[model samples]
Target: MGIFQRLMKNKELIPLAIIMTTAVAGASSFALYAFQKTDVVIDRKRNPEPWEMVDPTQPQKLITINQQWKPVEELQKVRRATR
Candidate 1:
């Protein structure tokens, strides 16, 4: 029998085609998912969400005893001592 006839009548080709199609579909799906980034940041400052956590970078306003306005914009400083 010719090669084409043999392949056409072969029972194994059906399973092989199914396997190849499944592999291609899975790879395409994975590639699509990999390109999508789910990180979305939403600022709630204008809405003033009561349950939302506050960012420490906002300036803390302080008042001195001498009636002076002191804005203490303190960012937690990490100091490493040299050996």
Candidate 2:
């Protein structure tokens, strides 16, 4: 006569009902997760840093080194001599 009695009488409908319930719960949880906004702020466009404004069209300039390269032994000796 009641909902439970009806469900017990129709056993095949139980699996269908369970599947529908699970699908609805999953869909609502996913909707909430996808739509919610976070507290984090992103302001890269309003206040741009010096490094962020590089011209991509121009060729990159190679840095010229004034100091000559020393031998590995000398560099190791200097490092070991230092505190």
Candidate 3:
């Protein structure tokens, strides 16, 4: 007999088969979404070219304090020095 005929012959298994199919489909879709690669940022400057590089001669830019920032208690200066 065909698979459909076999499935129909067993009424009790219909719900089970449906649940399993749904679970599998849901898991597969979630897996596909979770494992998909993120958008890549490509550096096209030296594609198929000779490799030549140099160390940075200057320091990186300094970060300035934001006006809206607040300091936490742990970072605050201690009022009394401990022995």
Candidate 4:
């Protein structure tokens, strides 16, 4: 009857057709995104200015925030300690 009817009659082909369609759509979408840029007015071939100046021997810092929650004394059970 139709092309789809022939594919349905052959059980191996239905899954392959679905996989091929999905692969083509995914690849085309990726290619389109790779070419389009929306923000800056600068030409792409020229070198753009750096957003931050390079600093050697800059001082480093570390900060930590700890939040611990403990059970209320009403929810606690007293147990005898054994050494």
TM-score of each: 0.36, 0.41, 0.42, 0.40
lDDT by residue (17-80, candidate 4, tens digit) is: 8999999999999667654523322454453532223222232223434544554564344322
Q: Give the 10-residue window scoring lowest on summed lDDT in candidate 4.
A: 51-60
TM-score of 2: 0.41
lDDT of 3 by residue, 1-83 (tens): 97679889988888988999999999999777654423221344644322222113322225534334454566355423331
User: Which residue pairs clash within candidate 1?
Assistant: none
TM-score ranking of the models:
3, 2, 4, 1
Task: Supply the global lDDT for candidate 3.
Answer: 0.55
Best by lDDT: 2
Give the backbone clash total of model 3. Answer: 0
| Per-candidate count of clashing residue pairs (backbone under 3 Å) | 0, 0, 0, 0
Model 2 RMSD in angstroms: 18.6
Q: For candidate 1, write residues 1-83 as lDDT tens digits.
A: 97558668996787777798899999999777654422222444654543234333432234434354443535212212321
> Which ranges of candidate 4 are over 4 A from the true structure?
38-83
State each model's CA lDDT, in order: 0.53, 0.63, 0.55, 0.56
- Candidate 2 backbone collisions, by pair: none
Better lDDT candidate (3, 4): 4
